[model samples]
Target: MRTHLKNDIPKFDIVHSHSLYLFHSLVTGHYCRKHGVPYIVRPHGTLDPFMYKRHRLRKMVMELLFENKNIKEAAALHYTAAEEMTLAEPVTFNAPGFVVPNGLNVSEYDHLPKNGTFRKKYPELNGKKIILFFSRINFKKGLDILIGAFDLVQQQHQDAVLVITGPDNEGFGDKVREWIGERNLTDKVIFTGMLTGEDKLAVLRDADVFALPSYSENFGIAVVEAMACGVPVVISDKINIWREVESNRAGKVSSCDHVQFAKEINALLANEELRSIIGNNAQHMVRDYYQWDKIGMALEREYTNILRTRERRPQSFKVRGDASV
Candidate 1:
């Protein structure tokens, strides 16, 4: 697919890529370099410790070969945060780099009605505080820890409902089910595997708190989505963009420790006023800083910088007049 696109598309100023490990990104980037077209690379959390631990050998080989070469020769590296920049710096073969956070369509969740369809589907949550976990079901996502923490939260507030969403990853969803079964949390925990359109929006609208205990994240797009929906987030410091969560007072930030995770979540579960205040702050921050228009402007500046540099000095400058002339 990538090779075809590279062959078909006309060469351009910059071929910006979001994730280096993706086959398409690699093929496209190589094409750009081959044609002397400058490119920008975005690793998108691919270099995080969690990712390295999972695919160490494969990534190491790719790094030693094409990926490192492509990044090294590119116009610049694009990172979402300082954490991502640091991760890219040493491995990038000394490429130029800049940081720009992932952005979202903030208004999509603004002033959204608390749609009762989701509540009606699981009417049991009508009277309870609904804490939500919405994303892919994967080990690195830390769903197991989120569930364990919720188990402790249930002991304090029996009325709390833990709603887990997104598509299952192989057998991991079943593992989550078994854990919930063992804890006898069938009533307190609800699993809606992969929802979209109205169904997905409804879940966000009715959510009381959003929790993501990811072991590592480059930008946590869902975190911003929840914030745009006016939902307070409870995330771990391992998420590279936790600075946004902390500086904005979007929600509580904790270490990956399960006990600390449980304690922080319980604090929010017990205090509705605090949750509302923090949730409001989260919405404002995403709207101001992460909205596409704002984020696009930041990217535009980077593109302009790359273009300016390219114009000043081509890959090979040619003098218009010879020394004899």
Candidate 2:
């Protein structure tokens, strides 16, 4: 990969590195600097306060060694959401930054599967109002809060079931299960491990509402996916895209507190009319803002601006006289 970058990087007008704290990005920054090419770094939530707390020592070491330099020297920083940029302010050192959200292939959601497909597979979910949470089961995903909220949800609507579908890549699933057990919600919550392709879509189609109360998310792609499928969402403000959701009236935004989260969930669960309205709003918002074609254009414009700005700047160093400086 380094070899490929070394050869091909000079061929491009500018470089865009996707994540921080990596050898590839470090090397890319070095090459970009060496070649006098401007590069943009997208931290992808690594600079979020919550992330810094998780692996403090290692990240601190990386930042002090090369990461900070890599960030400081970059021509621009790309953040997926405005909230991400705001949160990263302290670390970014007021670097030039812009917000362009992650997008989806709108075509993939053009036609949804039969609504009952997922329920047919899981007989227990047959006659229940489903609240779906579709993302990796991780500590940062706020599953503990979701469970606490679901416990309250079940009290109001016994017929409602919480469906969690995603890979437990972080080994946090057991802890989530323990939370569910403590709340006496073992039966009310269903963990389908991971669902993909049609299976994933089927569940999305069957869902009454999609919920992701993440503790901190730079951009919740799964939340967007649910919105694309015309499913109303209940997400926490901590998820950086909450502003888009709330402003567009596409979904409900709640505080990270479980009680408030449960209130938002219950509101959606109680009113089928309100759910349909928000669901339609969600679909419209995705089409208008989260489509790949639209995002591509926005990104292209950012690249163009960067190149144009670089062209306008005078060189910091130049060869002069016999010294070749």
Candidate 3:
């Protein structure tokens, strides 16, 4: 899928590519343009200023050569959040946009074991209040900040244990472990490498609080998953969905500062009633807003609108190099 597009590329009403950088999407976009099929571009948070600021010169050159054209020619820009739409609009100009959040199959939360499925496997976590950090172990995801905050959290709450689990990214996991050893926090923190399937869900279900102090996030599907499991989340304010979590009373949002991060973690870990109250609110919000039924309908409506409009005003479809409106 990453290399040449097979001659058997399936016929479709629309060609939707989720990115501009990934080579497969570039091939797919060029193919669609050649075939007169409209394509949709969804940045999935990559268009945010945080990412745009990382490699300005190279990115600007690429945008001028490829990404800019791909985006400008897209039928519509698909954003999971309104903020994403706002961040992406200038790049797309008159290209339309629609918002439909990523959602979970709420039914999956129905029969998860409520008890300590993870604690039973790792008995050391049996008595400790588990604070789970499950995501890519990378700096941008803010694992370093989380470790510093967890070190502080231990001073206030000795019973708390932090579990850092995820795939290593940019060799940051090794750095996190080294930091832990230097701080002599090996006893307070556990690095579980990577987990998936039942292992992932088990920890999320059993953890007392879920934390992802990311520097930037688009939708935060993991936060929503934690909320669906009735586990409250403590996330960074830069997360795009912090407003929803804050408004829903489902989680705590703090800036990337480890001081404030530790404070929120301590508050949730210290109060059982508070955890339960926010956990309940989190579950309700997931059911009410983040469910597949609600989000899928909105998504399907966009698909319908695109296809309907394409058929209605076939002239609206423009060629690849058609710069004219």
- What lDDT does candidate 3 reach at residue 268? 94
- The TM-scores, one per candidate, come to 0.90, 0.94, 0.89
lDDT of 2 by residue, 37-98 (tens): 78889888988898867778888898888889888998899999999999999988778999
Candidate 1 residue-wise lDDT, 178-272, digit = tens: 88998888778888999887788889888888999999888788888888887888998888778778988988998887778888888988888
Report the lDDT of model 2 for residue 185: 86
Q: At residue 105, give the lDDT of candidate 3.
A: 89
lDDT (CA) per prediction: 0.79, 0.88, 0.81
Q: After superposition, how far is residue 68 of candidate 2 from its true place, in Å?
A: 1.0
| Alpha-carbon RMSD to native, per candidate | 6.2, 5.8, 4.7
Please list the residue runs of candidate 2 whose C-alpha ends up more than 4 Å from where it truly belongs after superposition: 312-325
What is the RMSD, in Å, between candidate 1 and the native fold over all Cα?
Answer: 6.2
**Model 3 over residues 81-182: C-alpha lDDT tens digits?**
777777766666667888888899889887787488888888788789999998888878988788899989999989889988788857887788898888
Candidate 2 has which clashing residue pairs, if any? 318-325, 319-325
Query: Predictions ranked by lDDT, top down?
Result: 2, 3, 1
- Number of the candidate with higher TM-score, 2 or 3: 2
